[model samples]
Target: MQAKFLKSLMYEAQYKDYSPDFVMYDTLLEKNIPVVEFGSGTGRITLHLLEQGYRVFGIETDEDYQGFFLNKIKEKGFIDNFCYVTDITEVVEICNIIYPFNVLFHLNYQEVEVELNKLYKFRHCWSKLIIETDNIQYINSQSFRSKFNQNQDYFFKEFPRQSKSKIIIYNEVIEKNSLNIVLKFEYSLYLHKADDLNRIYNQIFPSAKLYGDFNLQFYRKNSPKLIAVCIK
Candidate 1:
């Protein structure tokens, strides 16, 4: 699927509201100075950080999302507070915090190691790194409907039959008036278990802490999300 079209549908159908993850990060605002967010889709979290007076640099791989993010921030008069980078290595070396929100899961185990190693190389530059990911055990392959606006809704389904290491998600936007599918797209992502994540990070950065949710609580077996906070 094209990045622009997928993002437009996602933003309208599912990402219109602030996520609970946002609230969780908000609590740590004071500690997240001069932040850098990886895979910052359409400036959702990036805009919030900029509005709160933080100097944020976003690293987005998608050209469409980068353009959309720049336009939105510019309109909000926060253009100066934010910068864009297409590669992680291009980021300025003085940032204190790094946010890899749901980006790690997009990579396979080997790829994740490479990315983590890259971040580890800059361990001395950044004091803290926050990683958010879906809890593989908590998610089930199923179909559901989500209400977007009064006139439209999204039908979501997941297929995990391909392999244990990955899942394919299918999304369709339906118009209520005609009950017709207006938009459809599918995307795939690699899956990572909590134990695997913990083992990987602990090996690289021994002091990394793992939490079950955004509330900063200890990781439970059944938590919906996995969050890792690594301090240098």
Candidate 2:
């Protein structure tokens, strides 16, 4: 069941902008760094890191995706170079290693951030952390409920009228003042409105360097699928 959900998501994500592999590989090639990916789905970024001979570790919440990655490592006999964990909050236990090649993308940012915060409770561990996901605004009064009703009433009629209230829950948890902004760009088409996204970006990542133009990816050149890289 987990595998099915991930597979479906991957199939959908392929059409979006920003190949995470391309971004990570470019950074690694330039910096000569190793990697550790959290919320890696089916070793999508993990496999690329492994193929490049980068020591990689992955944390996956989905058991089926975790199993799939484990099987791949086993099949390739990469006992020393690659590691994966199923639990969301498992701390990485790499000794004497300075930096790891990092590529992470999870659907649930609130859950993943809590787990990652637990795993790396002490800061200054990873030299780099790359994340990709839907943009959720925080500490802002945009009335996402109005947006949801305006955009999704035809499909989500069965749900509560204030369905977008959940968006606030996610934003409050994920967009706290812990991470510094690095880079942010759009990726998906169906996730957010472009105007809302730009406004949120200014609020959360006011200092982040824009990686590419708003339409650099497949976002109809005007969508709200943002791809951002931030620092701690």
Candidate 3:
């Protein structure tokens, strides 16, 4: 009903056809060990795994997305396999953790260090940790005539602001038909190079592997997405 929520929904819809990030981990995510998805907004990856019969626990704190995620879990016609996990300690199982999409980008490089350190304590409980985020070096190299992009419902603009520590994105969502600005917000992202992230992950986990994209190619400059797999 709200413009921001509507814009967010439309943004997610655009990724519906992109299945590589959502499906690539299927075999690694064992059915016996629980699957934990951080930032499981609107039940995209959560529902996909559930449909495949893998029990999933979603960790999210946003109330708006939480409401939608809960409703979607009910729509799946069963609640036994999916969990809206409020506390990480609540899940007491050896698990495969998914920290996908914009989840990591929301934290700055220092914050990433802190978070990964916290996750490191759960090394025994987690079998693996997968993180997907934007490649700041690649994105910064591009020259865009417009910072704006759109989906079916609304047109939005992302202004990337860089400071000593983080790359923050300031967003503006406008009404579709009227073209009137409807919502404005901003969030921070870690835009450091692959080696920076790899080092941090390696310090926390035994092995850390990074890919440029979902195809699992070795990470290189200009790669659009940075995907990291840390093995316990």
Candidate 4:
């Protein structure tokens, strides 16, 4: 992602509420174990976990997002409870929870397999691995505009027609006064079906459980998300 686009996303978080995935992970604080969150964008979930007295180690690939993430943790005075690294292989400490919240969707099938295999090595180190991703069946192409701030607005559109195996997202930010585009970017990701994801999970961790939503409900055809929880 571009730096400007990432900055816009960080701003979006100021207005938009936390996702259901955040709520789901927050409930696991009672486990009282250290957490390692992959793709910890802007430390949204990481901050919540840290505020709840749980130690969290964030792993993110994007340098732009990492800068904002670091600033937020410092601002909240939760720097002690949180730390971050740009590479996953650099994580040597054992954590009880592995959270890749809303992250797997960005990987292709091959990349997903590679990541799962790498994570499998830490099975003994972490008791649980929770992955949250889109339920491909439920994804639809749509467009809408929303307020970014007092003087700016963002127009978002998704076009999933380019390929059967991938989804494309387009984002644009415009200044209301000048009606000029301030930022624009396109993001694309491989589309993974529920069955395909579950099959991979079972192959790697046979004891994994699949849920359709944040409520821990059983998966179904029309569910909005496919959340997998694998226990060691």
Candidate 5:
């Protein structure tokens, strides 16, 4: 397979089937406020919302991921309901914002507070500011943090090197038949206390709430995920 096509293919296989966030996003949709999905990778949620008759403005810095989904949206005839830009600063409209999945892990609590303060003061619609991330505290508590998978066409592995405050995940994919390396991804995810995030966001939005998962349950120390929803 061609490199770009192969990467796109792998990306689809890795992410397409995960839909827990779908239910969460659906319940929060507002007709008049467009959803601006930060880190909207490959239109997973954007396309879903558009298909449900909601407008979406996707912000993604990765051009390859953006292009892959742009074509899909065009084919689905959802162009009128969606727009995309590479930078967050380029978004000018007020809308309900979502930092779905692990996108919030890219920033520490201080950084998140600073960014949310700026967003809340300027462009935030004040209806919602949804942020999601894995429970780094729980994840770090586990001894086995590595993962491996194999399929007919390719196999993938995740090797995480945890430090004091960040986890560096090294990922690689290999072709099955030829045993050749197909793609390698290295990423750093910052760790933050869920309570710290909740407190900081509460300062901005007095009604900020913390959930343990997509089901919107109260956060516990051992929960696998942390979801913070700030509503004014």
Candidate 6:
């Protein structure tokens, strides 16, 4: 990505009410775990990880973006501590087959399964994991899902309408298999208010408690962005 495109990404973040420093570094301060970031676009979070003394590996599919990351790594003289590769499918083969480092993944909602499937074997190897992706709530909403194509001029986006409709249409399978909570966890960001979430959860898992507030560091408050973390 060119610096201009990167800046455009940042500007979008700014428009959402998120500050640069908050999303860039401070959020990871409490944990000094080594990081392997998937879909590491333009080194946004990778640079902050390096500055905090944590070893960082970035996985990117686009060759141009991978080169951008490499150039930044060279300029910063972090050749040893920070590295990036192009293909994530072969990540486990290249690194340890088991737990290598705490994983940090940032991708679209459609790729959540892909990322999870890739790291399923490696999950036990790490001490912690963080997944940064779209809010399930937003994707499920008619307005938000439509906004993707509308905002981008509907060029070539693959909206995961099946995933959204699956949970609703197959509620019997969901309740019988205890998949309701998982669905809520994934889509909690779509709730406009805390009460809205509370009501939805009560309707689904009545006894479930709201664990915490949304961490808006990686997103602007009003924007449709959401970052969910699952630590095992």
In lDDT terms, which candidate is top? 5
Model 1 scores a C-alpha lDDT of: 0.69
Residue pairs of candidate 3 with colliding backbone atoms: none
Q: Alpha carbon lDDT of residue 35, candidate 4?
A: 84
Runs of candidate 1 with Cα error greater than 4 angstroms are 1-6, 29-32, 142-164, 171-185
- RMSD of every candidate to native, in Å, equals 4.0, 13.1, 3.1, 3.8, 2.7, 13.9
- Kindly list the per-residue Cα lDDT of model 3 for residues 12-88, writing each as its tens digit: 65564567775557745666777899888777788788888778889886776777667667876748888888756
What tens digits encode model 6's per-residue C-alpha lDDT throughout 1-232? 3332332232233233433434523553335555766655566666666776767767755554566667777889876987665444434432321111112222233343444555554545554444332333343356335212111211112222343324211111112233242111121122233233334334433433222223444334343433333344
State the lDDT of candidate 5 residue by residue for 31-87, as single tens digits: 777788988888888888887887888887777787788778888899888888664
Score each candidate by Cα lDDT: 0.69, 0.41, 0.73, 0.68, 0.76, 0.41
Worst 10 residues of 3 by lDDT: 137-146
- For residue 55, model 4's alpha carbon misses the true position, in angstroms, by 1.5
Q: Give the lDDT ranking, best first.
A: 5, 3, 1, 4, 6, 2
Q: How close is every model to the real structure, measured as TM-score?
A: 0.80, 0.48, 0.81, 0.81, 0.84, 0.47
Better-scoring candidate (TM-score), 2 or 3: 3
Better of 2 and 3 by lDDT: 3
TM-score winner: 5
- Model 6's TM-score against the true structure: 0.47
**Residues 1-232 of candidate 2: C-alpha lDDT, one tens digit per residue:** 3323333233223322435445534552324454656656666656666776777666655665666567667888875887764442343443212112222221233443454454345434544433344333332444323211111111111111222323322211111133332212222112333345444445554543333322335323333334444344
Count residue pairs with overlapping backbones in model 2: 8
- Candidate 3 versus truth, CA RMSD in Å, comes to 3.1
Model 5: runs farther than 4 Å from truth?
87-89, 123-126, 136-138, 141-144, 150-152, 220-224
Give Cα distance to truth, residue 222, candidate 4, Å: 3.6
What is the Cα-based TM-score of model 3? 0.81
Clashing pairs in 2: 34-100, 34-101, 35-100, 35-101, 36-101, 185-227, 186-225, 187-225
What is the lDDT for 79 in model 4?
82
